[model samples]
Target: MKILVVDDEPDVRTLFEQRFRREIRSGEFSFSFAYSGEEALTFLTGHHSEVVLILSDINMPGMSGLELLRHVKHDLIPPPPPLVMMITAYGDTDSYNQAMELGANDFLTKPVDFTALKDKLHAISTA
Candidate 1:
Protein backbone atom coordinates (compact mmCIF):
# COMPACT_ATOMS: atom_id res chain seq x y z
CA MET A 1 0.00 0.00 0.00
CA LYS A 2 1.12 3.53 -0.69
CA ILE A 3 0.29 6.09 1.99
CA LEU A 4 0.82 9.82 1.65
CA VAL A 5 1.53 11.62 4.89
CA VAL A 6 0.75 15.32 4.46
CA ASP A 7 1.75 17.81 7.11
CA ASP A 8 3.70 21.03 7.30
CA GLU A 9 5.76 19.79 10.21
CA PRO A 10 8.96 18.04 9.35
CA ASP A 11 8.96 16.26 12.70
CA VAL A 12 5.59 14.73 12.03
CA ARG A 13 6.88 13.44 8.70
CA THR A 14 9.99 12.06 10.34
CA LEU A 15 7.98 10.43 13.10
CA PHE A 16 5.68 8.77 10.64
CA GLU A 17 8.61 7.54 8.63
CA GLN A 18 10.29 6.12 11.69
CA ARG A 19 7.12 4.60 13.06
CA PHE A 20 6.34 2.90 9.77
CA ARG A 21 9.87 1.90 8.86
CA ARG A 22 9.15 -1.77 9.55
CA GLU A 23 6.26 -1.75 7.12
CA ILE A 24 8.39 -0.07 4.47
CA ARG A 25 11.28 -2.44 5.05
CA SER A 26 8.95 -5.40 4.78
CA GLY A 27 7.37 -4.04 1.61
CA GLU A 28 3.99 -3.91 3.24
CA PHE A 29 3.68 -0.18 2.55
CA SER A 30 5.46 2.82 1.10
CA PHE A 31 5.37 6.44 2.24
CA SER A 32 5.37 9.86 0.66
CA PHE A 33 5.39 13.36 2.12
CA ALA A 34 3.90 16.68 1.11
CA TYR A 35 4.49 19.75 3.24
CA SER A 36 1.56 21.71 1.91
CA GLY A 37 -1.82 21.00 0.40
CA GLU A 38 -0.84 22.41 -2.98
CA GLU A 39 2.13 20.11 -3.06
CA ALA A 40 -0.14 17.24 -2.12
CA LEU A 41 -2.48 18.06 -4.98
CA THR A 42 0.42 18.12 -7.37
CA PHE A 43 1.60 14.76 -6.13
CA LEU A 44 -1.91 13.42 -6.38
CA THR A 45 -2.39 14.56 -9.91
CA GLY A 46 0.51 12.42 -10.98
CA HIS A 47 0.12 9.62 -8.44
CA HIS A 48 -3.48 9.37 -7.29
CA SER A 49 -4.01 5.98 -8.83
CA GLU A 50 -1.12 4.58 -6.87
CA VAL A 51 -2.07 6.13 -3.54
CA VAL A 52 -4.25 4.05 -1.24
CA LEU A 53 -4.60 6.48 1.62
CA ILE A 54 -3.78 10.03 2.65
CA LEU A 55 -3.24 11.15 6.24
CA SER A 56 -3.38 14.91 6.28
CA ASP A 57 -3.16 17.66 8.84
CA ILE A 58 -6.15 20.00 8.74
CA ASN A 59 -4.43 23.28 9.59
CA MET A 60 -1.87 23.69 6.84
CA PRO A 61 -0.75 26.89 5.20
CA GLY A 62 -2.02 27.91 1.73
CA MET A 63 -4.47 25.02 1.53
CA SER A 64 -6.06 23.27 4.45
CA GLY A 65 -6.81 19.56 4.55
CA LEU A 66 -10.53 20.29 4.52
CA GLU A 67 -10.05 22.11 1.25
CA LEU A 68 -8.06 19.20 -0.11
CA LEU A 69 -10.72 16.81 1.05
CA ARG A 70 -13.32 18.78 -0.84
CA HIS A 71 -11.25 18.68 -4.00
CA VAL A 72 -10.61 14.97 -3.69
CA LYS A 73 -14.23 14.19 -3.07
CA HIS A 74 -15.56 16.25 -5.93
CA ASP A 75 -12.80 16.35 -8.50
CA LEU A 76 -11.01 13.02 -8.56
CA ILE A 77 -12.25 10.49 -11.04
CA PRO A 78 -12.21 6.92 -12.40
CA PRO A 79 -10.64 5.09 -9.47
CA PRO A 80 -12.18 7.54 -6.96
CA PRO A 81 -10.46 9.44 -4.21
CA PRO A 82 -8.02 7.79 -1.84
CA LEU A 83 -9.14 7.23 1.73
CA VAL A 84 -8.58 10.58 3.47
CA MET A 85 -7.97 10.75 7.20
CA MET A 86 -7.76 14.18 8.76
CA ILE A 87 -5.50 15.00 11.66
CA THR A 88 -5.68 18.20 13.65
CA ALA A 89 -4.18 19.59 16.78
CA TYR A 90 -7.24 21.71 17.43
CA GLY A 91 -9.96 19.13 17.41
CA ASP A 92 -13.48 20.44 17.83
CA THR A 93 -17.00 19.72 16.76
CA ASP A 94 -16.94 22.19 13.91
CA SER A 95 -13.82 20.78 12.35
CA TYR A 96 -15.04 17.24 12.81
CA ASN A 97 -18.33 18.01 11.14
CA GLN A 98 -16.68 19.81 8.28
CA ALA A 99 -14.28 16.99 7.64
CA MET A 100 -17.06 14.42 7.68
CA GLU A 101 -19.18 16.52 5.40
CA LEU A 102 -16.30 16.83 2.97
CA GLY A 103 -16.00 13.02 2.79
CA ALA A 104 -13.13 12.39 5.10
CA ASN A 105 -12.86 8.73 5.94
CA ASP A 106 -11.80 9.42 9.51
CA PHE A 107 -10.43 12.08 11.84
CA LEU A 108 -7.66 12.01 14.41
CA THR A 109 -6.61 14.46 17.07
CA LYS A 110 -3.03 15.58 17.40
CA PRO A 111 -0.53 13.68 19.52
CA VAL A 112 -1.60 10.73 17.45
CA ASP A 113 -1.55 7.37 19.13
CA PHE A 114 0.22 4.76 17.07
CA THR A 115 -1.88 1.91 18.39
CA ALA A 116 -5.13 3.57 17.41
CA LEU A 117 -3.73 4.66 14.10
CA LYS A 118 -2.55 1.13 13.44
CA ASP A 119 -5.94 -0.33 14.23
CA LYS A 120 -7.72 2.17 12.03
CA LEU A 121 -5.34 1.46 9.16
CA HIS A 122 -5.79 -2.28 9.55
CA ALA A 123 -9.55 -2.00 9.54
CA ILE A 124 -9.57 0.34 6.58
CA SER A 125 -7.14 -1.82 4.67
CA THR A 126 -9.26 -4.93 5.22
CA ALA A 127 -12.53 -3.20 4.50
Candidate 2:
Protein backbone atom coordinates (compact mmCIF):
# COMPACT_ATOMS: atom_id res chain seq x y z
CA MET A 1 0.00 0.00 0.00
CA LYS A 2 1.11 3.50 -0.74
CA ILE A 3 0.62 5.95 2.13
CA LEU A 4 1.33 9.60 2.34
CA VAL A 5 2.18 10.95 5.77
CA VAL A 6 1.73 14.68 6.24
CA ASP A 7 3.26 16.47 9.20
CA ASP A 8 5.25 19.61 9.80
CA GLU A 9 7.68 17.85 12.08
CA PRO A 10 10.93 16.88 10.36
CA ASP A 11 11.56 13.92 12.65
CA VAL A 12 8.25 12.32 11.69
CA ARG A 13 9.77 10.85 8.57
CA THR A 14 12.49 9.16 10.59
CA LEU A 15 10.10 8.01 13.25
CA PHE A 16 7.67 6.42 10.77
CA GLU A 17 10.57 4.78 9.01
CA GLN A 18 11.75 3.22 12.24
CA ARG A 19 8.30 2.17 13.31
CA PHE A 20 7.38 0.53 9.99
CA ARG A 21 10.76 -0.74 8.91
CA ARG A 22 9.64 -4.29 8.59
CA GLU A 23 6.73 -3.46 6.31
CA ILE A 24 8.95 -1.21 4.22
CA ARG A 25 11.60 -3.85 3.77
CA SER A 26 9.09 -6.57 3.14
CA GLY A 27 7.46 -4.57 0.32
CA GLU A 28 4.07 -4.66 2.01
CA PHE A 29 3.92 -0.89 2.25
CA SER A 30 5.49 2.18 0.73
CA PHE A 31 5.45 5.57 2.39
CA SER A 32 5.90 9.14 1.26
CA PHE A 33 6.27 12.10 3.58
CA ALA A 34 5.16 15.70 3.20
CA TYR A 35 6.35 18.31 5.67
CA SER A 36 3.34 20.59 5.31
CA GLY A 37 -0.25 20.60 4.16
CA GLU A 38 0.71 22.45 1.01
CA GLU A 39 3.36 19.91 0.21
CA ALA A 40 0.92 17.14 0.82
CA LEU A 41 -1.55 18.74 -1.56
CA THR A 42 1.04 19.05 -4.26
CA PHE A 43 2.04 15.44 -3.84
CA LEU A 44 -1.56 14.34 -3.90
CA THR A 45 -2.32 16.28 -7.02
CA GLY A 46 0.46 14.51 -8.74
CA HIS A 47 -0.01 11.03 -7.30
CA HIS A 48 -3.36 10.71 -5.63
CA SER A 49 -4.30 7.68 -7.62
CA GLU A 50 -1.43 5.65 -6.25
CA VAL A 51 -2.00 6.64 -2.65
CA VAL A 52 -4.29 4.32 -0.79
CA LEU A 53 -4.32 6.26 2.46
CA ILE A 54 -3.16 9.48 4.09
CA LEU A 55 -2.00 9.93 7.68
CA SER A 56 -2.06 13.60 8.62
CA ASP A 57 -1.28 15.61 11.72
CA ILE A 58 -4.21 17.87 12.59
CA ASN A 59 -2.42 20.87 14.10
CA MET A 60 -0.01 22.55 11.73
CA PRO A 61 1.41 26.04 11.29
CA GLY A 62 -0.04 26.78 7.84
CA MET A 63 -2.91 25.04 6.04
CA SER A 64 -3.83 22.83 8.95
CA GLY A 65 -4.67 19.18 8.48
CA LEU A 66 -8.40 19.81 8.72
CA GLU A 67 -8.17 22.12 5.74
CA LEU A 68 -6.20 19.51 3.91
CA LEU A 69 -8.84 16.96 4.80
CA ARG A 70 -11.48 19.22 3.34
CA HIS A 71 -9.59 19.49 0.13
CA VAL A 72 -9.01 15.78 -0.06
CA LYS A 73 -12.52 14.77 0.88
CA HIS A 74 -14.45 17.51 -0.88
CA ASP A 75 -12.38 19.67 -3.20
CA LEU A 76 -10.00 17.67 -5.30
CA ILE A 77 -11.97 16.40 -8.24
CA PRO A 78 -13.19 12.97 -9.35
CA PRO A 79 -14.57 10.26 -7.15
CA PRO A 80 -12.93 7.96 -4.64
CA PRO A 81 -10.86 10.08 -2.32
CA PRO A 82 -8.11 8.43 -0.37
CA LEU A 83 -8.88 7.28 3.16
CA VAL A 84 -7.60 9.88 5.62
CA MET A 85 -6.78 9.35 9.27
CA MET A 86 -6.31 12.41 11.45
CA ILE A 87 -3.77 12.51 14.24
CA THR A 88 -3.59 15.16 16.93
CA ALA A 89 -1.62 15.60 20.10
CA TYR A 90 -4.58 17.35 21.70
CA GLY A 91 -7.27 14.87 22.56
CA ASP A 92 -10.10 17.36 22.39
CA THR A 93 -13.75 16.99 21.50
CA ASP A 94 -13.97 19.83 18.99
CA SER A 95 -11.12 18.66 16.82
CA TYR A 96 -12.42 15.14 16.76
CA ASN A 97 -15.90 16.29 15.86
CA GLN A 98 -14.60 18.62 13.16
CA ALA A 99 -12.47 15.91 11.65
CA MET A 100 -15.36 13.48 11.53
CA GLU A 101 -17.60 16.13 10.01
CA LEU A 102 -14.92 16.77 7.42
CA GLY A 103 -14.95 13.03 6.53
CA ALA A 104 -11.96 11.52 8.28
CA ASN A 105 -11.83 7.74 8.04
CA ASP A 106 -10.51 7.58 11.59
CA PHE A 107 -8.99 9.78 14.30
CA LEU A 108 -6.07 8.97 16.53
CA THR A 109 -4.30 10.67 19.40
CA LYS A 110 -0.64 11.51 19.25
CA PRO A 111 2.19 9.41 20.57
CA VAL A 112 0.40 7.09 18.15
CA ASP A 113 -0.14 3.57 19.32
CA PHE A 114 1.76 1.57 16.70
CA THR A 115 0.02 -1.64 17.62
CA ALA A 116 -3.43 -0.17 17.23
CA LEU A 117 -2.36 1.69 14.14
CA LYS A 118 -1.13 -1.54 12.66
CA ASP A 119 -4.40 -3.23 13.46
CA LYS A 120 -6.41 -0.41 11.94
CA LEU A 121 -4.27 -0.42 8.83
CA HIS A 122 -4.66 -4.15 8.46
CA ALA A 123 -8.40 -3.89 8.79
CA ILE A 124 -8.60 -1.05 6.34
CA SER A 125 -6.36 -2.85 3.91
CA THR A 126 -8.48 -5.93 3.92
CA ALA A 127 -11.66 -3.99 3.54
CA error at residue 83 for candidate 2, angstroms: 0.3
lDDT of 2 by residue, 1-127 (tens): 9999999999999998998899899877899999899999999999989999999999999999999999999988665899999999998999999999999999999999999998888787777
lDDT values, one for every candidate:
0.90, 0.93
Best by lDDT: 2
What shift in Å separates residue 124 of candidate 1 from its native position after superposition? 2.4
lDDT of 1 by residue, 1-127 (tens): 8899999998887798788788778877788999999999999999999999999999999999999889888987755789999999988999999999999989999999988998787677677
Q: Which TM-score value belongs to model 2?
A: 0.97
Which residue ranges in model 1 land beyond 4 Å of their true spot?
Answer: none
The worst-scoring run of ten residues by lDDT in candidate 1 lies at 118-127
Tell how far residue 54 is off in model 1, in angstroms. Answer: 0.7
Report clash pairs, candidate 1: none
Model 1, global lDDT: 0.90
